[model samples]
Target: MSQALARLPGLGPRSARRAVLYLMKKRENALRPLLSALQTVAEKLSTCSICGNVDTSDPCSICTDPRRDEKSLCVVEEVSDLWALDRSRLFPGRYHVLGGRLSALDGVRPEDLTIDQLVRRVSAGGIDEVVLAMNATLEGQTTAHYVAERLEGFPIRLSQLAHGLPVGGELDYLDEGTLAQALRARRPIA
Candidate 1:
């Protein structure tokens, strides 16, 4: 069990062992409920076909919400970034999760992401702005540029998360206040 838990993203062997022991000691109040929740999620969770968000419902609530700003779209490198932006409550726009960034060394390309689908979404009309909310990494910047080129001349404004964020900052790691300020001060790209 400890080894299994350690396979999860940030967990180490020692931490996982401690966590497993803790859960076992609190089985009734924690482990059972956690198991039930995990089972439920595994049974019901699905990726939103439109935005790549994980949700019980297709298209996800954000894509279906009538209150969202249909004329603006936030493009993210992954669903975690979408959740980070949502946590900030700074953007009312819909989202388009790109799955991952372009990485030449890793052989990831524009085709590996949802760039074509994003262009198609924008081309469908009503998108006045497209916010590039990728991480502040070289791959992220490269992917953003490729996307911007794909979206050029589409009439929609293109922008990115503003300065103040460190060079390698990621939206998922930023506080709500910082995220809000970045969104408020976003700059145009093309």
Candidate 2:
């Protein structure tokens, strides 16, 4: 059990063992409730067809929200980044979750992500800007550049999250305040 739990991200053997003990002590209250919640999530959670957000809704609440800015779209490398931006409540625009960045070292390519779908969305019109909010890594930047090149012929403006984010910084790990600041200070990528 410890080994299985340790296989999860951010959980090591020692931590898994501790968690198991704690769960055992509170099996009825904590452990059972957690199990039920996880089961429910597993059964009902789905990826949003429009924005790639994982939720109970097919389009997700953000995608279908009447108040969201349809003219602006924020591009991110993962669903976690989308959630991070949502937590900040600083962006009123829609989102396009790329799923992952271009990583030649890892054999990740543009086609492996939803880049083409993004192109179609931009080409279809009504979008005014697309914000590249990927991580500050070489691979992330490479992905952003590829996307920019793909979208160059379109009339939509392109921008990136501010340099306020440290090099190699990931959106999911940052606080809401920092994310809000970054979004507020975003500049055109050119």
Candidate 3:
């Protein structure tokens, strides 16, 4: 159990051991409820057939929500990224999870991702804009470019998430790559 818990992201061996100890000490309060919840989630949760998101419903609530803009689609590399963007609530649009980014070193490819599904979605029409919300990494950019090329010739607009310094980042502490990107993406404050 400790090894299994430690295998999870951000949870090291020490933390996993501590968690196991706590759970054992509070078995009635913590372990039982946690087990029950895990069982329920395992039994009820499923992947969304439309956008590849995990939810209790087949299409996911976001995919089925009528209030969301069907004309705009935000493509993310992972379901976690999708959750992060949705948590912000800044984008009132639909989403497409690409499963993973293109990485030749890691053996990930366009075929491994949901690029085909994305193209099919765009081909179906009603989409006006497609936001490539990939991470600021080499693989992410490569994947974004590949998706853009695949989406070429479509009437839809293509855009990418801006890469730059964080809101409270110090200029002196920043890296040159980030500074360069910030300079390149600079906009006039009208």
Question: Which numbered prediction scores highest in TM-score against the true structure?
Answer: 3
What tens digits encode model 2's per-residue C-alpha lDDT throughout 118-190? 9999999999999999887688888988999999978888998765667788999987866887898887899
Candidate 1's error at 166, in angstroms?
6.9
lDDT (10s digit) by residue, model 1, range 1-190: 9999999999999999999999999999999999999999999999999889999999799989999988999999999999998997789989999999999899998888899999999999988999999987789988988899899999988998765666788999988877886888787899
TM-score ranking, best first = 3, 2, 1
Report how far off residue 8 is in candidate 1 (Å). 0.9
User: Alpha carbon lDDT of residue 187, candidate 2?
Assistant: 76
Model 1 Cα shift for residue 143 (angstroms): 0.8
Ranking by lDDT: 3, 1, 2
lDDT of 3 at 76: 96
